[model samples]
Target: MDLDDHGLTFSADAVMDETEELRNPFPSPPSHYTKYTTHNLDLLALYNERLPDRRNESQAQILADQTDVPDWPLTQLEKPRIDWILEEPEPYYDVFGERWFVKDKIPSLGEGGGTQLYPEDPTVDRRPALLGILRSLLVTYSQLTSAILAPPPSINLSPANTEPPKPEWEEKVEWITVLAQNLMAAANDLRPVQARGNLELMMQRQLQLRREETKALHDKCDILDAKLNELRAAAQLISSRGDSTDVAMSDPTPTKVVPDDVLAEDVLRWAEEVE
Candidate 1:
C-alpha cells in the first residue's frame, strides 16, 4: 500500500529524527485525535516560585504579593520532555556510578573518562542482576500453590573444609571460570543430543535402503522362479510327445498307436500335476 493512500507518510518522522535539536526543526507534527482526547496538566512546583520569606514579613504582605496559581497548573508537555531526558542536561552530569573499578582501564577522552554508560548511576554486577531477574520471574510465573508440590531446598552434601578466604580478584577469576565451565558443560550436553539425532537419521536411512533392496531382490527371484516352472512344464510336455512317438514306432499294427484324444488326456494330467 502507498503511504499517500493511507495518509501515513513518514517524512516528518525521518526529518525530526535527523534534526537532533532541542526543538524539532521540521514542521509541527500534524494534529491527531489523541491531541484532542488527552487531559494534559503541568505539575511543576519549582523553588523559584516560592514567596519571599514569610518570617521576615507580615501575613497580609505575603498575601498581597502571592502569585500562586490554583487548581490544575498547566500542560507540562509545553516544557518539553526531551529537554528533561537528554538535551542540555549539563547541571546534573557530575553524578556517577557507585563504583567503577574499570575506570582507569577505559580509554580517556580529550577531557575526562571515556563516556557515561546508559542509566549511568549504578554498577549492576552481572551475577546479582541476573539472579534478581531470575528470582522475580520465578516468583511471578510459578503456578504451584501447595508446599508439598514445591521442590525441596538443596543442601550441601560435601564435607566442610576450612580454607582461608580468597582475595577479591581471585574470587572474580573463580566466578568467571565457573561461568565459562558451566557454559561449556551445557554446550557439551547438547552436542550429544544433536549427534544422536543425526546418527539415528543416517542409520534409519541406510536400513530403509537395505529393506528396499531386499524387497527388489525377492521380487526378481519370484519372477525367475515363475519362469523356471514354465520351462519345466514345457520340457515335460516335449518328453511326453517323444515317448508317445517311440511307442507308436515300435507297435506291430497301426491300431496300437495312441489316439489323439488319449494323448490330449495325458497332457492334461501332466499339466494338473505341474500346477
Candidate 2:
C-alpha cells in the first residue's frame, strides 16, 4: 500500500495478488514486512473507527428532537467572610517539620521585643487586627526614625549609655529614610518650586507696594513743603505791607512801635507751632 495526498493506492499486480488471497479468505503466514504493514494498517483502521461518524438527516432529526431537553441550572458558591483565613504557605521554615500552612507573624517592639504571633484560623479571621498593628508599627517607626535622622540638637549633650530602641523603631527609621527621599524628590517637582517662587513673588509685590507708598508719602511731603514756603512768603509780604502802611500813617516822626524783627519772630514762631 502506498499513501499519498490523493489517498491510499496499490499497484495493479499487488491488487491482483491481494484479490486472489482475499477470494480464498485465509490468513497468510506473517512475515516481517507483513507484520509491520499489518500493524500500521491496524492503527489506521482503529483511528478511523474512533472518529465520530458524519450525521445523516435521520440522525440530525433525532438529535433535534432532544433539543428541548431541560439543562440543570448552575448553583453559586457562598462568598467567604473578611476574617476567614484562606490557606497560605508558611513564610518561614522549621528545622524539623513538613511545610504546612501557618499563621502570619509580625515583629513587635514592646517590653519584650519579639515576634508577635497572629492567628490565621479561618473562623477567627484577624486580618483587621493585624492590619491595625501594622499601622501602629508604621507610625511608631516614623516618629523614631524622624528623631534619629533629625539634625543634632543645638545644645551639646553628655555621652551616656541608653536603652536600645525597639525593632519597630528601626523599621520606622528605615521608613522615614525612604519617606524623606520621596519628599525630597517631590520637593524638586515643578509645582512645589513654583509655589515657593509664587510666595517670593508675593513678597516682592508687597515690597513694591510699600516702596510706592513711601514714594507717595515723599511726594506728599514735597507738596507740604511747597505750601509751607508759600505761607512763609505770604507772611513776609504782609509784614512788608504793614511797614509801608505804618510809614504812611506816621507824622513823619520816629514813632516807636514793637520792632518789626520781633513781630516777624512772633509770626514765624506761630507758623512753626501750627506746622
Candidate 3:
C-alpha cells in the first residue's frame, strides 16, 4: 500500500533503515548518505543539537567509536542514538505546540474490551479503562480546592444526648459544707468567752451611768439641805424679834424713877391699855 494514501507519508522504518546503511562498513558509503547531503546532514545536525552535554565522557567516546567518528572536536556522527530516538515528525505537534511526536493505538468501544474513546449515545453505559485514573485526579483536585476554600469544621463541647455531669459544682458544695462545719466548731469553742466579754462591757457601762445618776441625786439633796438651813435661820431671826417685842411691852416705863408699888400699878395700867 502507498503510505501517502492513508495520510502517512513519512515512515519510521524507512528512516531507521537508511540510518543502518550509513553505519554499515561492507560497501562504500553512498553519496546520498554523506555528511554534505541535505537529508543526511539535516538529520546529523538535528542529532547533534539534541545530544545532552551531561552524558559521561566515556559514553561519548563509545558513541564516537560506534559511528567511526573522531573524538577530537565532537561532530554530529559522534552523537548518541538517544538524541534522534524521539525526533519530531513533520505533520503534527504536541498539545503545548512542542515538537515531540508519538504514535499510539486508541482502542474503540468494542476492541478487546479495552477503554472506549468517542463514545456515542447518552444511555449506553461503557466502562473505560482510564476511569480510575480520571476519578483519582478529580478527587485529588477537589480535595485540594476544598482545603483551600472551605471553612474548618466546628468542634462542639456540649454533650450530644444528655447533659454533662456537674462534678465541679458538687465539689464546691462539699467544700462549703466542710468549711461551715469547721466554722461552727470554732464558734462553739469560743462562744462562752465572747459572751462573757460582752456581759462585762454592758455591766461597766451600766455602773458608769448609775454613778453619774447617784452623784446628781446627792448634789440635789445637798442643795435642799442648804435651803432648809437658810429657812431655819430666817425663822430664828423672826422668833428673836418677837421675844424682844414681848420683853419691851412687859417692862414699859418701869425703869423711870417709879417705886415698886408704882411699877406694879403702871404694869396693871399698861396691861389694861394693851387689853
- Write down the TM-score of every candidate: 0.26, 0.24, 0.31
Candidate 1, residues 166-255, lDDT tens digits: the string is: 444444444444444433443443565689999999999999999999999999999999999999999999999999999988987747
lDDT of 2 by residue, 91-208 (tens): 4333122333346443222213423334424256545655665566578676886777776545434567354434445666666555444333333333655998999999999999
Backbone clashes under 3 angstroms, per model: 1, 2, 0
**Deviation (Å) of 93 in candidate 3:** 99
Candidate 2 — which pairs collide? 83-125, 141-172
Q: Let me know the TM-score candidate 1 reaches against the reference structure.
A: 0.26
Q: Which ten residues in a row have the lowest lDDT in candidate 3?
A: 90-99
Regions more than 4 Å wrong, model 1: 1-189, 254-275
* C-alpha positional error of residue 70 in candidate 1 after TM-score superposition, expressed in Å: 99
lDDT of 3 by residue, 1-275 (tens): 23553243556777667566655655345433345545444545544554676354543453543454432333434444544555745333332223443554332333445332323332454235135434544565555565556565454466664654544434444444443443344344456679999999999999999999999999999999999999999999999999999999898574756555666777889999999
Q: What order do you get sorting by TM-score, best first?
A: 3, 1, 2
Best model per lDDT: 3
Which is the winner by TM-score between candidate 1 and candidate 3? 3
